[model samples]
Every structure is written in structure tokens, then in C-alpha cells.
Target: MIKHELAKLVEIAAREAQSKDLIPPTALPEVSVERPQNPEHGDYASTMALKLARAARMNPMVIASAIVSSFPPIPGVEDITVVAPGFINFRLTDNWLREQVPVILGAGASYGSLDIGKGQRVQIEFVSANPTGPLHVGNGRGAMLGNALANILAAAGYSVEKEYYVNDAGSQIEVFSNSLHARYLQALGKDVAFPESGYGGQYMIEVGQELATEYGEKYLDQPSQLGAIGLERMLDMIRVDLANLGVVFDSWFRESSIYKEGKYQAIMDLLKEKGYVAEREGALWFTSTSLGDDKDNVLVRTTGVPTYFAADAAYHYDKLAERGFDRAINIWGADHLGHVSRLKAALTGMGIDHQRLNVIIMQLVTLKRGAEAVRLSKRTGDIITLREVLEEVGADACRFFFLSRSADSQMDFDLELAKQQSNENPVYYVQYAHARIASILDLAKDRDIDFSDGDVSLLATEAELELIRQMILLPEVIEMSAHNLEPHHLPHYAQELAAAFHSFYTVCRVVSEDIPMTKARLKLVQATKIGLARTLALMGMTVPESM
Candidate 1:
């Protein structure tokens, strides 16, 4: 909000220059106010003068001076100055920074809420790992991204629905069933050849053993039924893994559900009627090149079986047409980036706007422990499960580490650093800041210090002001994350906020010898606590009252 106010001031200055014939009367450019990376420059900086100089036929320095002279008085701005290349820098008054404490205290958890979404219906489907095995660390990244995105969107005023699209009716499920069948036969002491494409995880063997224990050799001849039972058991495991990581889906949309409910066939028929589908070589083909795809895609193979693309496209159609969500977002691994455009094209062919369907391709994740690549799970398998890493570091640390990086960039999560209690671990550092502030607040309460009417004006130190500045940026962070559909900004912002609080704690003691200063700093500490808790909540992380 301070940034917007600064932009308005720049516009007013531009208008005054126009009235005085100092510049042309053309429409003004949108002013962008950015915080200078160097603290010496000031609180906010704008480069409008340089943008206007060419059109106005005047030196940017002269124009900046003219605008500065005509600038009207504003309450929070302590000082304004023009520097090299006609950049205007603004410094906030100490009173204004101090006033934010009560505002923050009063706002509490709802401080960062925005109305950008206007209650639009949004569905974020993520961590839809097949019902084959437990969730791996790669799928864990998508889990964190989707759940945090839903939280951010809800804070931005959208009606968000968290979904997990289960690929229950596909080759993956078939292979999983066969794998379980083989394991069951083996558990029955019958030799069987393993399917080369089947899952070889030890969990498959466990599922097979369970099946054998539950039903002996009854399912030996009914192997298809055995696979279906195994699928349900596998899904149960996946659900538990997700729940342990603080993720719960509002909907578990089954790929088979679309077909069972007739939605899939209806959508395919609609595509055919719209001439977007063609039958070639006894297979149903989607004319994707009709909407700018590189090649046409097959919807059904010659064997009369639908492709995974068909199920995915049908699922999206259900979200956009049958269920009627305004937006549908799918969090998929980067290995499926090639599937994005064709899916969007299919949506376009169905008379739905392609923009409504958003597929976020998450890059790969590599786990590391003390600089060594951790490729194998502690379990008897090569793939590391999400539950294993979560148990090693912690659910909070795992989620924080996954959300710390952009979904499009590959990230290496360090199991060693995540478990550290020192400030080297970012999650620990942020949580410790919350715990320290809580201790300070409790101390104030124990000392019988009355802070209801504390003099906020006493917070005049540079560290205190900087901390206040960072505290107020939470709303902006939410708004930016909502607009960009990226939640990585939250973890980085939390770290900076924690650093500001840490610096303030070092310089300005909250429970100090001076009672008046202590009460004022107590209010500041309480405000910081609110901010840190809100940041943690946004990322679905817990804020421990004590470390």
C-alpha cells in the first residue's frame, strides 16, 4: 500500500509538471516503486523521471528537481531526494513505522488477506501419484506446491478446492495389479516371472504377502481381482503419506469415475461432433494441430483402449464443463511437460478456454545428506519415499524445503541442514523467531507491564524500523504469489522477516531494564509474532510457541 501511495505521488508530480509546461500533456506512465537493495538509498525508489525525460525534452535531473519541488506533503514520508539518473528515493517516518504495530496487532491472522480473486472457483489438483506405491520425494514437491498455492489463493479471496486426480483406470494400475499378482503367487510358494514394466518396490511384495495372508490361494486364478484389491491398499498408503505431510484433498477425482459416470464418453462424443476428433487406422485421434500443436494426438489406440491423454483431457473437461470450476490447475512433474500443450489444445477444441486449465510442470528434486546424493530410500528400494524424508528431517522441514524453491527449477534438499537446530536451517530459523517472540511476550505479561497504551513512538532504531517494514510486506507477498500462482515467495519472505526480527532482537531488547521501552518493544515483538505465524500458516507449517 505504501508503494501504491508513492506511485500516486509520482503521478501528481508528473501532472504538476504538465500544468507548468515542464513536460508534454500526454498520459503518464504507470509508476513502479521498488525498494532499493542498498539501505542507504531509502525505503522506496522510482525511476519515472528517466522514463519521462525523452518525451519531455528536458534533462531527467531537471525534471526530477521540478517534480520534487511541486510534490505535496504526505503523512508517512519522512524525506524525499533525487539522485543520479533522476531516481526519487523515499524514507518513511519513524512514527509511521511505529504506528504499524497496533495495526498489525489488530489485524492478527487476517492481516495479509486480499480481494484479488473475488471468490472465483478454483481447483488445484496435485500429488496425483498413481496407486502403485508410496509417494516419492518428487511427488512431495508437487504436494507442497499445490497445498500452499491453495492456501495462498484462499487468502487472496478465491474459493479454492484441493483435488487429487487418481489415475485408477490406466496401464499403470494394470501393471501394479500384475506386480501384486506376481508377488501373491510368489508368497504362495509358486514361481512366477516378474513383469519388466511392473513396480519392483518392496512395498509391492508386502502388498502381495498381505493378499496371500488375507485370501491364501483363492485369488491365484482371479488375479485381476487381486490387482484391484492391491490398488485400493496402495491408495490407502498414499493417502496416509499425504495426510502425514499436512495435505488433505477436498476431492479425490478418480480417472475411472469419469468413465463410470459417463462424463468421459460424453466429452469424447462432444469432441467428435465438433470435428476435433478423427478416426484413423481404427484409432480415435484428436486433431491437435487444429489448435497449433506440433502433431495430432491419439485419443484411443487401435486396440480400442483410451490413452492416458484421453483420461486427462476428459478430467479437465469435467472440471471445466461438468463440474464448472472457473479455473483448473494441475501440478505435474517436469517429465510431463510435453503433455501440457496437447491437453490445452484439447480443452480449446472442447469450446473451453485453454487459459482456464493451468498445468504447472514441477522440476525434479534430488535429495542430499551431508553433500552426498541420497538416491536410495532407507527402505529396500531405490526410490526415496516422502514419508521417509519427512521422518528424517520433519514434516515442517520437509514442507518448508520443498516450498523454498520454484516449481520450474530443480532443487536439492539437504537432509543434514534441515535437521539442524542452528540458524543454518531456514525452517528452524523462522520457527525460532516465533518462539523467541512468544517468550518475550510472555515475559512482558509476567512482569505486570501494561502494554495496551504503550508509546509506539519509542521504536526509533534502524533495526526496529526495518523489522516493521518487513512485517507490513506480508500482504504484498500474498498478492504477488496469488497473481503469479507461485508460493515459493512465502518461504523466502519468511526467512527475510525472521532475519529482520533476529537483528531487532539483538539490538533492541524487548524485556529490558527500562520499563517504558520494554512495553513499546513488547508491542513490536507481538506484531512480529503475528507476522511470523501468518507466514508459517500460509505455507501450512506449524509455528511452535517454543523451540
Candidate 2:
């Protein structure tokens, strides 16, 4: 919000300078206001003058000075100066920074909320991992990423829905069904051999045994019935695993439903009508090359079976047109990277804005025990399950570490480090800051120090002001994260905020004999607690009051 306000101020100053004939009457460019990396430069800096220098044919310093001279006085701005290399810097008053303590305290849990979205509808589909297998640590990355992004969008005032798209009608499901049936026959002591293309995870055997124990020979004559039972069991397992990782989808959209409801056929007809579909060698193609794709993609194979691309196009149409979400965000794994462009082209062929669909490709996650890489589950002999990681560390640590890196970057999850209880663990370190604040607040309460009317103006120490500075960045951080669709920023920002609080606590006494100073410091810590807790909550991590 401060950055926006400062950017507006710079625009106004530039226009005013233009009117005064101090600069050429060129059209105003987009203004950018960013924080100076160096502390001494100022709180916020702008390069509008430097950007205009080329067009105005004037020295950048002269332009900066002219703009600063014409800059209107805005509250909370302590000083505006023109630095070398044509940068206009604006510093916030320390009094204004300290004044935000009461504001943050007053806002409570809603401190970082912004209205940037204005209640637009957004549906985020993530971790739609096939029900054929258990979710591994890799799927956990996309799960946390989508959940956290939904939180950020909601905090920014968007109506958000988390969805899990069930690929229940695909080739993978058919294979899984065959595998389950084979195992079910084996469970009945039949001489059926396992399908070569069958799933090899031990969970499949358990499902088979459970099916045999539950329904016996009734399903031995019915492979479809056995497959349906196994599919339901696998979905139940996936749901429990996601719940353990702190992710719950608001909707479970079954891919089979589209065909059952005739939406899939409807989409195919629409694409054909739009001239985006063509028949080639008994196969139906999407003709994506018309939309600038390097090659055409198949909508249906020569075997008359529709491809996954065709099903996804129908699903997206349902999401944006029938369901009427303003935006649809899909969080997929790296393997689905090839689907991104074709899906967008499909949307375009459907008379929808391709920009409305955003697909984020989350890279792989490698689980480690100290320095050694651990890939397979000790129990299932498959990729290590997210449930196993959650059981070992916790939902909180899993969410924190899964969201620590950008979705585009591969990350190694250190199991031994996550299990640590000390400050060496980031989630522990951040939560400890909140716990420390709680103890300080308890100390104030025990001493009968009434901070209800704490004077924020008395908070002038560098540590106090620095802590306040970090506390107020929450709104900016939320806005930036929402704008960029990057939830990774929240975890990093939480760590920085916690570090600022720890630094403040080490140098300043909160329950000192000086009642006035103690009251002010207590209020500061209380504000920090609110901000730190909110950040952790947004990242889907638990904030411990005492640890």
C-alpha cells in the first residue's frame, strides 16, 4: 500500500513538472517504487526520473531534482531526496512507523488482509494426483503450493476454492483396475498372474486383500466392481494423506463425470464447430498449430478413445464457463509441463481468454535423511509417501519446507533437520518467536503492567522501530505474492520477520522497571506476534503459542 501511494506521488510530481515546462511534455511512463537494498539510501526509492531522462533529453539528476521539488507533501513521508544516478528516495517517519503498532494490534488476525481481488472468483486445482497410487513427497510440493496460494488470494479478498481433479476415467485408472483385479484373484488363491503393466506398490496388494476379505467371490466374477472398490479405497487413502499434510480440497471433480454428464462430447462438438478440430488418419487432432503451437495435438487416438487433452479441455471449460470462476489456476507436477501450452490453446479455441488459465509446474522434491538421499518408502517399496513424511516430522514442518522454495526450483527435504526441536529448524525458529512473545505478554500480565493504553510514540529505539518496519511489510508481501502467484515469499518473509523480532528481543527488555518503556515494548512484541502468526497461518503452518 505504501509503495502504491509512493508510486502515485511520483506520478503526480512528474505530471506537475511537465506542466511547469521543467521537463518535456511526453506521456507519463509507468512508475515503479521499490525498497532500496541499502538501508541508508531510504525506505523507498523510485527510478521514474532515470526512465524519463532518455525521453526528456535532460540530465537524470536535474530531472530527479525537478520531480522532488514538485513532489507533493504526503503524510508518513519523513523526507524525499534525490540520490546520485537519478534515484528519488522517500523515507517514512519513525513516528509513522511506530504508529503502525496500534493499527496492527487493532487489526488482530486480519492485519495483513488486502482488497486487491475485490471478491473475484478463483479456483485452484492442485495435487490431482491419480487415485491409482498414494501421494509421494513430490505431490506434497504442489499441494502446499496451491493451498498457500489459495490462502494468499483469499487474504487479498478473492473468493477462492481449492479443488482436486480426479483422473478416474483415464488409461492409468484402467491399468490400476486391472492390477487390483489380478491381486484380488491372487488373494482368493486363484492362478491368475499379475499384469505386467500393473502397479508394483505394496498398497495394491493390501487393497486386493481388503477387497477379498470384504466381498469374497462376488467380485471374482466382476472385475469392474472390484476396480470400483479399489478406486474408492485409494481415494480414501489419498484424502487421509492430504489431510495429514494440512490440505483439503473443497471439491473433488471426477474426470468420469464429464463423460457421464456429456460435457466431454459437448466440448468436442464446440471445438469442431470452431474449426479447431480435424480428422487425420482415423484420429482426431486439436489443430493447436493454428494457435502458434509447434505441432498439432491429438484429441482422440485411432482406437476411438479420447486423449487426456480432450478431457482436460472439457474440465477447464467447466471450470471457467459453466462454473464461472474468474480465474482457474492448476498446480501440476513437472511431468505435466507439456500439457500447459496445449491446454491454453484449447481454451483459446473455446472462445475463452487463455490468460484466465494459469498452470504452475512444480518440480520434484527429494526426501533425505541427513546427508543421504532416501527415495523409496520402507513400507510400500514405492516413492516415499507424504503421509510417511508427515508422520515423521509434522504437518507444520512439511508445509513450511514444501513451501520454502519456488515451484520452479527442485528442493531437497532434509528429514533429520526437520525433526530438530531447536532453532536449527526454520519452522521451529519462527514458531519460537511467537512463543517468546507469549511468555513476554504473560510476564507483563503477571507484573500487572497495563499495556492497554501503551503509548506507541515512546517506541524510539532502533530495535523497536526495526521490528515495526518488518511488521508493516505484511500487506505489501501479501499483495506481491498474490500478484505474482508466488506463495514461496510467505515462508521467507516469515523467517525474516521472526529474525527481526529475535534481534529486537535480545537488545530490548520488555518487562523492565521503566513502566512506560516496558509498556511500549510489550505492545511492539504483541504486534510482532500477530504478524508472525498470520504469516505462518497463510503458509498453512501451525503457530505454537508455547514450544
Candidate 3:
């Protein structure tokens, strides 16, 4: 929020300079206020003058000075200086920074809440992996990314809904059905060849055996019915797997519902009416090339079966147009990268703004055990499932490691490191900071010290001020992550905040003989606890009171 406030100051100064004819009347560019990496530079810095120099036909330094002259004095702003090359730096008074401890304490868990989204309805659909098997480790990455984004966006004041779009009706399902049928017949002592392309995971065989036990010969001939039952079993496993990883969707939307409710046909009809649908080679095609795609995509095959693209178009249409979401964010795997442009084109064909549909393509994750690569699951003999990882590293470490990198970057998950109960692991390091603070608070409580009347003005140590500086940036971090659709920032910020608190703890002694100083430092430590816990919570990671 301070960044926004600084940006507003720059904007007002620019307008004042323009009105007085001190600078050319050019429309202002976006005011960018950023924290200077070096504290000596200032608390916050902006380069608006440098950005306007070329357009205004004036020296940047002169422009900066003019803007500063027009800038009004703001409380808590200790000084505003125009540095070389036209950098406008703003520094906050230490007293003002210290005063924020009580404010953070007052806000508690909601300290970082912002109003950037202004109540826009945003639907985040992720980890909708086909309902054929358990969620692999790769799906875990998308799950954490989506869940964290939903948390941060909601904190940034957006009405957010997390959803999982189930692909229960497709060729994949057909293959799974055949596979289950073959296993069922085998379970019943009937020799039958398994489908060549059927799911080969051991879990599928287990499901088949369970199905045989539940219904003997009643579904022996009903492949479709057996398939339906098997699909529900797979979904149940997927739900449990995701739940263990701490990901619960607000809704589970079935793909079959689109066709059952006639939305698929309605969308096709509308596309045809808009001239975006065409018939060629005995197949219905979407003319996406006209809307900037590389080529047209098939909507319906020659056999009269609708393609997956058709179902996806209808699903997104329902999400954005019918259900009334202001925006729909779909987190997908790297394999679906090619479908992005065509899907946007399809949305455009249906008279919807393609920009409203945001697709995040997450790269693959390579699980590792120190120097060795981990690929197979001990139980399924397939790619490792999310449940396996969660059971090994626990949910907090799983979520932390999954979200440590941007969604677009391929990451390696080090199993050995994640399970380590030491500072070498980032998640452990951050949680240890919270646990340490909790211990200090407990010590203070045992000593019968009341920090209720703590005066924040007495806090002035470098470490204490630095910790407060880090704590106050939580709101800005939430807003920035939500605005950029980058949830990775939360984890990185948590580490930085933890490091700051650890530095403060090393130098400052809480519950000392100096009662007033003890109370003030305890209040600062409590504020850090709130900030750290909130950051961890936003990433769907747990805050452990004791390591």
C-alpha cells in the first residue's frame, strides 16, 4: 500500500508540474515506485522524471526538481530527495516505521489484506488432470500455484473461487473403461485381453478387483456401467490425494455436464452463427486462423463425436459468460501449451474477451533424492503420486517446494532436502523463525511480563527497524503477487522476512532486566509472528509452533 501511496505522490507531482507549464503536457506513463535494494538509497524510489524526460524534452534532473518543488509535504515522509539521473526517493521516519508494530498486531491474521481487486469475481480452475489415475507429482505444482494464487487474490480483495474441472467424459475415459472391464473379467476368472492403451498402473488393477468384489456378474457385461463406477473410484482417490496435499476445490465441475445440459450444442450453434464454425472434410472445424491462430481446429470429428476442444470451449463459456466470473484463470500442464492460443480464439469467436481467460502453463517437475532422480512410485510402479510426496515431506514442505519457483519454470524437487529438519531447507528455515518467536513469547508469558502497555516509540535498534520494514511490506507483496499472477513471490518474501527476524533476535534480548525495552521488543516479535504466519498461510503451508 505504501508503494501505491508513493506512486500517487509521483502522479500528483507530475500533474502539478504539467499544469504550471514546468514540463510538456504529455500523458503520464504508469508510475512505478519500487523499494531500493540498498537501504542507503531510500525506503522507496521512483523514476517517473526519468521516464518523462524524453517526452517532455527536458533534462531528467531538472524535471525531477520541478516535480519535487510541486510535491506537497506528507506526514511520516521524513524527506523527499531528487537523486542523479532523476530518481525520486522517499524515506519514512523511523518513528513512523516503529509505530506500525501495534497496527500489525491489531490487524492480526488480516494484516496484509488489500482492496486491489475491488470485489471482482475471479474463478481459478486448476489440477483438472484427467480422471483416469492418481495425481502425479507434476500435478502438485499446478495445484500449489493455483491454490496460492487464489489465497493471495482473495487477500487482495477479489471474490475468488477455486475449482477443478473434471475430464470424466472423453477418449481417456473410454480407454480406462475398457481397461477396467478387462481387469474385472480377469478378476472373475474369465480370460480377456487387456486394451493395448489401457492404464497400466497397479492402482487400476486394485480398483478393478474391488469392483469385482462389490458386484459379481451384475456389471460383468456392462462395460459402460463398470467404467462409470471405476471413474468414480478414480475421482475419489484423486480427491483424497489432493486433500492430503491441502488442496480442496470450491467446486468439481464435470465435463459431461456440458453436453448433458445442452451447453455444448448451444455453443456450437452460436459459433456457427458467428461464422467462426465451418464444415470441411466431413468434420466441423473452428476457424481459429481468422482470429490469429496458426490453423483452424477441429470441433467435431468425422465420426460425429465432439472433440475435447469443443468441450473446453463450452466449459470456459459457462465459466466466463454464463456463470458470471469477471475472469477465469486455468492452470495447466506444459503439454497443453499448444492449446492456449486456439482456446483464446474460440472464446473470441463466442463474443467473449479472450483476455479474460488466463491460462498458466506449468512446466514439469523432476523429483530427486539428493543426486538420484526419483521417477517410480513404490506402490503404483508409475510416476510418483502427490500422496506419496505429501506422506514423505508433509504438506507444508510439499507446498513450499512446489511454489518456490514460478509456474513457467521447470523445477527439481529435492526429497532429501525437503525432509531435512534444519535451516538448509527453506521451509524449515522460515517455520523455525515462527517457532522461535513462539518460544520467546512463551518465555515472556512465564516471566509474568505484560507487553500490553508496550510503547513502540522505544524500538530503535537497526535489526528491530529492519524487521518492521519487512513486516510492513506484506500488503504490498499481496497486491503485487495478485496483480502479476505470480504466487512464487510469497514464498520468497517469507524467507526474506524470516531472515530479518532472525537477525533481530540475534542482537536484541527480549524479557531482559530492562522491563520497558523487554515489552517493546516482545511487541515487535509478536508482530513478526503475525506477518510470518500470514505469509505461510497464504502459500497453504502450515506454521509450526515448535520445530
Q: How well does each candidate superpose onto the true structure, as a TM-score?
A: 0.94, 0.95, 0.95
For this target, which candidate reaches the highest lDDT against the unseen true structure?
3
lDDT string, candidate 1, 210-278, tens digits? 899999989988767998888888788888998887888998888988889987798899999999999
Query: Per lDDT, what order, best first?
Result: 3, 2, 1
lDDT of 2 at 294: 80
Alpha carbon deviation, residue 527, candidate 2 (Å): 1.1
TM-score: which is higher, 1 or 2? 2
RMSD of each: 2.4, 2.2, 2.3
Question: What is the C-alpha lDDT profile of model 2 across 219-266, one tens digit per residue?
Answer: 877777678878888899999988877788899999999999999999
Quantify all predictions' global Cα lDDT against the true fold.
0.87, 0.89, 0.90
Model 2 segments more than 4 A misplaced: 367-381, 414-423
Q: How many backbone collisions does model 3 have?
A: 0
Clash totals for all models, in order?
Answer: 0, 0, 0
